[model samples]
Target: MDEVEIVVAHAERATLRVGDVFLKVDVDRARAEAEAEAMALVPVPTPRILWHRPPVLAVAALPGATLGRLGGPVTGSPTAWAAAGAAIRQLHDAPLPSRTGRAGRSVAEVVAELDRECAALVAEGILPADLVARNRRVAETALRPWTPAFTHGDLQIAHLFLDGDRVTGIIDWSEAGRGDPLYDLATFTLGHEEHLGDVLAGYGPGRDVDLDVIRAWWSLRSLVAIRWLATHGFDPHAPGCEVDVLRARM
Candidate 1:
């Protein structure tokens, strides 16, 4: 029997690896079911669903290393990053999945969450008041209305799987839903600003990604996430991570 490796665990969800299979266990089975459905809906490659038995959704691990991770060296080349961007464009362009309890957070919902999280971060001294305030202002550009697209709600850098210059697959679709495409762009490139141009190049430059909105998302996401990360035994202050991203914006 293969030994089980704990991939990630938090209060709400956990992922375990046993050889080639990854088991994602979520408290809400609906989200797991949605992940499977979302994978089927997306145009890009996704992990093959081995089985989904309620709280646990098992999948065959895809080939290749993760594109990169926050606060770590990028293992992928420029071509690979561009390819990831193109994959994102393809995902965004795919037919809008019926909202049908799939996954989504309205702008109002997001604003409320951000506001609440920002207050806690400052109140708890997890982040400075001024830093939080500054980023709040920066985050405002993302609050307006946007034409909805099929968005990978949490497009972390580690989510994209690249084999050479080709995007082999993407993982984690529990957050898949219609949303502002810029949020996906912002999340994928978060903490890795230098790659934005390359990503946009592959995403198609003429499409016009407002730099300010992207910047706002960076600030908003960082500010909103700092407290949770700090609580969850992750460090937002690490080099090339969330805090650094916020400081750079100053």
Candidate 2:
């Protein structure tokens, strides 16, 4: 091929050729801001272009493999789930950067953000606008005594990398933040209960788990997930799916 046709996919904030000068993008600025507060995460195969003007990251190309080809239940493996949990624990315990500013706003602030997002979603006729109100009471009740820990913000199978039963890497630090650690767990467990069990087992009993809070997050998270799926032409119906199950529960 004389020239490669590259499609910059979802959640990619910035992209550049290996030798091309980088231009600042909002994603790059956010990554820079987060790097000061967090330990550098484990490296993955994605090509990272480091020496551009504003600095751009080019993800390492996937090697003739796709998630669809990986087959089933890699996520349900306890060893894999546990390994993922351990990686997150390491991230949570990493020292706060001196240059890092104050932590993200309170859970209340997160709730407010959710409220605003829900309104926007509804206004656009994207999702059931009342979803926020339906779960707001539970979310508020669940927030009491909420303990904050490092959160991967978005954690799931697609964001993880595995070799058989081992977790070789966790991809996509784009949404990493300091928040309720259980939120990550809830994110993991939403549809995959067995994997959730394995992750918890690996994390051990020392983790303070509040099932109620997880339930609340599951409901809220699923609502958000559904909206995203709608935006991207993905099926809402499938077995062993958390979003569908959670919506039913809601």
Candidate 3:
């Protein structure tokens, strides 16, 4: 039987795998365009763009499995994680994409959005009020200004693919843009905090990164993402899930 896997399905977009091709369906044309353009600009390995028509994008699958999955133990070795980090650094050092307007979100605007989302979560009783409030306070540190670098705005582990210690490719460029460098690092290590040192080591020396701000992003992202995940029919309360990630910050 031919295999077909639903990679992700959410309000914004859906990604499916059929045979060796991955198809992405996005509701926003601009975001899809940005992703196409960003993939072209990034220096790191990326999935080959097979074709694009309106809402659907087709790309050839890359070699190797994902670096890890959310709410699960990382199967990839430390070397693979380090390789992924180095790849991220390489992308960060690359020149920014020409049209990055879609990636620009001011800290103030993000905080405002976070506040609104947090309020919704509290009102809906989706999470404990104190847990949400505590993480909200912790998230405030990441609201400061930063010098923008080319960032994979969503650098979750699953987006990174590796073969042994070699990084084969990175998938999901929809959120790629000029943004905080630490945001990428933070997002990459969201739930997998223990492996951060390995990533930082591979990120190499002399790059100034604020660890506290990175931690702040971890808190902010998990808290803000819970409602969206639940709305998308994902279980945020699973063991080692987003909710547990927030609680770990307490």
Per-model lDDT: 0.87, 0.53, 0.87
Kindly give the number of clashing pairs for every candidate.
0, 3, 0
| TM-score, per-candidate, Cα-based | 0.95, 0.68, 0.95
| Candidate 2 residue-wise lDDT, 1-250, digit = tens | 2334333334535333233222224355667445322325323222243432333433443322212211134434567667666665665555433332222346666677667756766788754645545665555544555555666666665656556555555544556665667777776666665566667666766667877777777766655555665555454445555335444455
Model 3 lDDT tens row, 161-188: 8888999899888888888888899989
Candidate ordering by TM-score (highest first): 1, 3, 2
**What would the per-residue lDDT of candidate 1 be over residues 66-91, giving only the tens digit for each residue?**
86799998877788888999999998
Alpha carbon deviation, residue 124, candidate 2 (Å): 6.1
TM-score, candidate number 3: 0.95
